[model samples]
Target: MKGRATGGLIVALLTLMLAACTVVDLDADGKPIMPKDPNAKPGYSNQTPQQIAESGWASRVQQPAEQQALSWADMETKSHTVKAGASESVFVRAGGVVTAFDNSNARERHLTMTINGKPVQVQIGPVLRSNAIRDAAGFRFDEFTNQVQYAQLTKALNRHAVKQLPAVDASWVGKPVQALLAVTMAPGKVDDVVAIQLQQGSP
Candidate 1:
């Protein structure tokens, strides 16, 4: 009888351990329980990094939603060193990664570009569209996102294609920027772009 009792205790302990692992502490309605991260706070997504306490993953970590739409329109950009007769590139910083966006997308938002002190308006494209979430490994197939097929996935994800640039600058002539970047949650709206960044190099 003592041996049987010991076995039962062990089983109970094992069950408790398993329960702990499965406990996600979701809200009453099964939504993810948002933490105290300032970024997750209500209306934080629309605020700029400087305007708010912090931005990027730090904000997302505390937010209730697993995904957030980031936008940057009418963002004032810095000068870039573009090479003669080469493709100029710009980066969009999101979730800690500085990824290139399609030129068509940039043009749609009327993103301002300055090359060698000359302002130019251009669209951008993503050099790396999709990224694998480090923690999303080996979950079910539904959770898997193969970044390799980013082109097709992004094409489906972005509803509207390049439409129109409300503003355009012709000063970018004869100048090339090594790098440029911007971010936004709203598109086609006349608003200051958020989280603008740039780099200079030959590509």
Candidate 2:
């Protein structure tokens, strides 16, 4: 009876061991492995520029207050130097026309204007980045060189009928327009304009 009981006990232990071996899955190093879902889709990490633009991802990205403050501070500091060009302030109001709008470089749109009786080339962008002034000011990309808008602006400028006009217009090509200009200080050199506003009134 004792020997029969011992054989039965050994069989029960073997069964438990077999069950454990079947149930417990382990890696080669003895760590338990996580079961992966077969229906999961693969992730895409690389996105093209067009894809990014279409996604409007940049507008969703938020900058921390501290970072934004710093950016504004830096912008102010740079603007101050330009602003100092004014005898009492950094902003000078002047009238001008779009003497030339060169879009030769798709990324950087160069606008040459006759301001204060001098030809000033204004650099509009490296449009790929958010730091572009034109983008910041809400100017449409095509408005810079749209032919219809250009013709209208030129006609208005030629008429010289409007004494006070808005600083910016979709149709202000050849018109006498005013803008607040930020001048850069350089020794023995004509100051470059850092910023401009197409004004619609006498300053």
Candidate 3:
């Protein structure tokens, strides 16, 4: 009986190997003939990044705080909050805050921002792991037909943000200052806020 069972196992293994080695038939164009599904959606938008940026970005950034953004304090207590994996635009005016520019990572130069009243760390970046600026710019998902269009928009915004900052030097380090931050937020009690437009001055 044991010998019969071993033979059956060997036969099963051979069957699986044969199935795994099945070759796909090719078409006249030398491409594999894939089975067609009627429900498949495989189209992307032909809209250019320059066209997209020109159409709506100016109006989005120019919108007033009352119309376009919510206060940082209001988003807490569950009243106004961006859901997890969602993004929101916020305009914040903070004074006497503790912050420092850490250029340790040349690739991701960012300021470690610690607002006095709020318990959140604000990070400025062209390449940080947050997409608040991209998502919070009043853009609808349907506007972008594919992932590529969405990604390029973020790159355009980052270029604009880098121009908004003062020269990367020791002029504003460890000083008593005020900051007006137009930033984006994601869900959670307090974490990182990606600043879209940041302005600073001595208090």
Q: In the order shown, what is each candidate's alpha-carbon RMSD?
A: 15.2, 16.2, 15.2
Residue-wise C-alpha lDDT for candidate 1, range 1-203, written one tens digit per residue: 99999999999999999988744578789898755667642443333333322232334222311233221222223112223343222223322222223245442433344433434333332222321111111112232234433333333222211111112233332333332232221222212222222333334
* lDDT-better candidate, 1 vs 2: 2
**What is the C-alpha local distance difference test score of each model?**
0.31, 0.41, 0.57
**Model 3 stretches with alpha carbons more than 4 Å out:** 1-47, 64-67, 78-93, 96-98, 118-120, 126-128, 176-187
For model 2 the TM-score comes to 0.32
Top model number, lDDT: 3
Tell me which of candidates 1 and 3 scores higher on TM-score.
3
Scored by lDDT, model 1 comes in at 0.31
Candidate 3 lDDT tens digits, 1-203: 99999999999999999989858799899999876678865322655665565554566543543264554455453323557776565555555444567667765666655554543454555455555555556566666777778888766665555555555434555554454455654565544465555555554
Lowest lDDT sum, 10 consecutive residues, model 1, at 130-139
**How high is each candidate's TM-score?**
0.21, 0.32, 0.59
* Model 2 alpha-carbon drift over 4 Å, by segment: 1-89, 126-171, 199-203
- The lowest-lDDT stretch of 10 consecutive residues in candidate 3 is 71-80
User: Which stretches of candidate 1 lie above 4 Å from their native place?
Assistant: 1-114, 117-119, 124-144, 147-203
Would you list the rank order by TM-score, best first?
Answer: 3, 2, 1
lDDT (Cα, tens digit) per residue for candidate 2, span 60-176: 111111122222223335554543334111333455777775667765555576755567765443332212222222223344334444334322221221222133333545655
Highest TM-score, which number? Answer: 3
